[model samples]
Target: MRLTGLLGIEHPIIQGPFGGGLSSVALASAVSNAGGLGSFGAHVLHPTAITGLVRDLRAATTRPFAVNLWVPHAGEGDPIDPTPHIARLAPLYRRLGVEPPALPVAPDFTEQVDALLAAAPPVISFVMGVPPRWVLDSAHDKGITVIGTATTVDEAIALERAGVDAVVASGSDAGGHRGAFLRPVEQSLVGTFSLVPQVVDAVGSPVVAAGGIADRRGVRAALALGADGVQIGTGFLATRESNAGDVHKAMLHSDAAKVTVLTRLFSGRTARGIHNGLVRELAAHEDEVPPYPVQSGLMQPLRRAAAERGLADYVSLWAGQAAPLTASRSAKDYFKELVGT
Candidate 1:
């Protein structure tokens, strides 16, 4: 089936689900109303909140939309003691006028999934890893189209074998977190041009190309490379409907986009963002940083403070390498521009 038939949308464009509350009902509904699949990144939300978010999205638009969640792992390794990292950031927290963190409780993935299943969004996408067999079965039973993110051909094959409806072949150039599950993220740093067709050739499922795609040219390139559709993140994040902070949005349009860097400073998982003071300061101390959510939790106060102060330094201005290509417009207008509508 063509992408339009697969997702029942007029265009093959999808707004990448931005996690950490950066996604909004307004943005999702805007994209959906404009004839594309909009999505909410529900990774950080609790079960009840997930239900409420779904209800909110449904109320906003009857158009087909998607919800995304991170497939929970016991993390990549054993949880490290977070005290040292918290202490290191204490000075920054004090400057921001917020207390430093104590230990943080990781969100319950099972409860989140159960909540999502109950809400029953039209499509559910997984990143970082694939969901369990029973969860996939449950989603299928509920008539949800399960899409999994892959950074390599092996990961794409794995998802197809797991019976997912589609696989997003996310190249390393993509913004936000690397969804490499089988190999180390550094080893899976394949460019979009190289990755998409390889994934398409290896899997029977439809392939959605993500990473460094911001304009019509990029979209056409992905489709030419055999991608059934395109998933865009930084492009949508720059839109007026997005919840990205003023500082983050400004950075995307500024010269800072020319020097995007991948570092674990923001969330302790490798993420691509514009280079700023915070990232530079913490770059040398990568080993000291705790795992994903722990480091993310520890830095929450700083991020919020940075946002309030309009300081881009501490905020995670997650963007792709092609961030400068993003346009500041409404999600609908941006969608139209991307598809040349």
Candidate 2:
């Protein structure tokens, strides 16, 4: 499929938008220059930083790209209360020479939204849920194509009704946060093979498939299964341009890659990643993970220490299920290999 005319791109490949210190200028530009849509996860960045990032990406590659963000959805879950989870990880933090932070982090999403307008990337993809109607309308008015993630046909139809340009069917095999807008993630784990066609059948818009797709064969399979485009994350994590830590890249090639488990320890939201020591422990005690931003906030100190000391367990190293077969290459080379398959 044409992937909605991505500025003369021949392949329907979109670099999966990764956030929480993964999206990088080099990675995005490389994909764009390679005749595929490069996407930057801008939800973690503020307006000025995002604008500068967009400008740098433009300088690096003349081709078009996208900026992605998470829609701020309302929830009844307590925003603050790391007491339950922090109590569990306090011993680990004390050992790391850092004090865990308090809960209920008010992430600066509004500033990020402002930044997206200034950067005005050709496309804006949202995860976590569909944005407010005004946000969608404003984005379209600015000529920004909107893509929203869904895990089921119900979610896909919701996105279509919300005026999204495309619906990304993020199956259960996908890494990172599971965008379950319709039901709890546990009950909505639809694999791409089963979810894509159903979503396409339910919606009039384009359907993008993600989760466990790491190569050209996966891309071809998605197309055969009724996907207009395929979004690959774990495959690109091993690429040279990716900002993932060295430990993360190494893990992609290790046997532990096959043992991925879904845990809510880091973000208090269900996400799958490599099963590390911390993952093993967390899996046994995941019920204590507070709530969204709270758990994410309390884990910052541990994650920062881990990053500084080359420790993998302290961070939420999100990766798809196809991690074991990962191959390292430049972003452009990675895309070539993908489209070639």
Candidate 3:
């Protein structure tokens, strides 16, 4: 297929990049060596850390791999008070025996882009929004393959216009933060089955289907829908090689995973995850939560403390709706099953 040729991999499977410390070099390299496109999410990392991450991944595997970033969207760097959001989570903080953290300073996007370009990885993928023209031009000059994420046909067209090498059709069923940018996330919640073909038809770039895909069946379905490849997240996140904590991985294997929900409580942005106490308690005030990075920063201390203590209730259990279908195994084995080889 075009995606396999474009990515120079034997299989057209891409391991969905996981941020917030869920991605690992071992996991990424394993998939790349196994002839699939492995990815590391470096959005939350500093510029130097991103360079180090690329170096580690290159050392682990000689095959092509991708580094994912979030193109800073609007309002991401705006000054906002976190006091009320902190007050809202006061109970959870007290329960976890952690204090509210100070406001967080997000890493500069321009600096990150420069660092990534200097590292010159084989492929670069973006979500949330498109990077500046200079960033794209620089990547092409370096012979780097650029991929963009889209939740709708219009978004896919936008990426194509921006000259991306490939476009990932990220459906609403996907886990982690929503990548919607052109419109409100609530209006962009299209299912994978419906979104993939439309995106494939709309964009000249190869289309990669994401969201609610775990096993061989999902892969085949995506291919039938004209997708050039498939990207699986929750499936890989549940694997032993992933950096997700034991509690988070265990929850994916349980019945709790079957009851996934889209909520903004975790990071002030809409995302799908296995429903738990935190989501239920804050369901009433989701609209009042501070925007991302702010809410995400305020909850960091509590999430960390809870995770250290093996408490899943307070930790963000990011997973797709296909969590129940996820099997715990090595990433290589999971990739083999996904490609049915």
Candidate 4:
């Protein structure tokens, strides 16, 4: 496959770069060493943590891997005071026996980029939008491959025009935040099968299909639809090597996984996850919540407390629509199952 050649990996499968600390060096290296392209999402990390994470990945495996960043780090637009949002979440924190959450400052995208370039991972994938021309030029000069995530064919065309080495056609069925940058995510809700061929026909770059893809059959379908590779998120999240909380991992394999919902309750951005209590409560008045990262920040205390205390009600159980189909327990085992090795 063209993606396998470009990424220099044996399998056309790519593990999703899960953010918010769900991604781990252990998980990424496991997949990469197994002959697939592993990835870690550095979007939720501080600049210094980003550097350390890349260094750790390099030390863990010699195989090619990717470190992902949100092109426009969350909370970049007109600043919204998170005071009211924090107030709203205060009760939740109190119930969880945690202190009120503090407002969050946006991570410096420039510093993170600089750190990423200095570390020089084989591939640097980004979502939300395309990187600037100068950024792409710098990555190319460093011999790093730039991959962009897109929700629509127009976004794919834009990435190709910007000179990305590859584009991930992220369908609405995927977990976490939608990568819609050109238009509202609702308008960009094309499925993996429909979006892949359209993107392949629209752009010259290789396409990696994401969303609603968990097992080998999904991988075969992606390739048959003209995608050069497949990126699996929810499937990898269930792996033992991943940093996902035990509760979150268990939810992926439970009957509850069959019913996933898209809600902005966790980060003020539409993301797919198991429909739990908090999601049910906040989803009704989602507009009252602050923007991305702000709402995310405001709820950090509750999420942390829930995770530490083994409470699943307040945690963000981020999973794709195909969570119920997740069939692997570890990254190494998953990669072998994916490749039929």
Model 3, span 162-235: residue lDDT tens: 99999999988899999999999999999999999999888888999999999999999999999999998999
Candidate 4 lDDT, tens digit per residue, 1-341?
Answer: 78999999999889999988899999999999999999999987888988899889999999999999998844465677767777787778778888875576767788889999988999999999989898899999999999999999999999999999999999888988888989887898898878999998999888999999888889888889999999999999999999999889888888988888878889878788899989777766777887687778778888988988878888899999989888647788888887877
Give the range of the ten consecutive residues with the poorest summed lDDT in model 3: 81-90
Candidate 2: clashing residue pairs, number: 0
> 143-239 in candidate 1: lDDT tens per residue?
9888899999999999999989889999888889888888888898999999999999999888999999999999999999999999999999999
Minimal lDDT window, size 10, model 2: 75-84
What root-mean-square deviation over C-alphas does model 2 reach? 1.9
TM-score (C-alpha, index-matched) for candidate 1: 0.97
Give me the candidate number with maximum lDDT.
3
lDDT tens digits, residue span 173-231, model 2: 98888888778878899888899889878898888899989987898899998889988
Structural RMSD, model 3: 0.8
lDDT of 3: 0.92
State which candidate has the highest TM-score: 3
Give the deviation of candidate 4 from the true structure as CA RMSD.
1.3
Off by over 4 Å in 2: 2-8, 76-79, 102-105
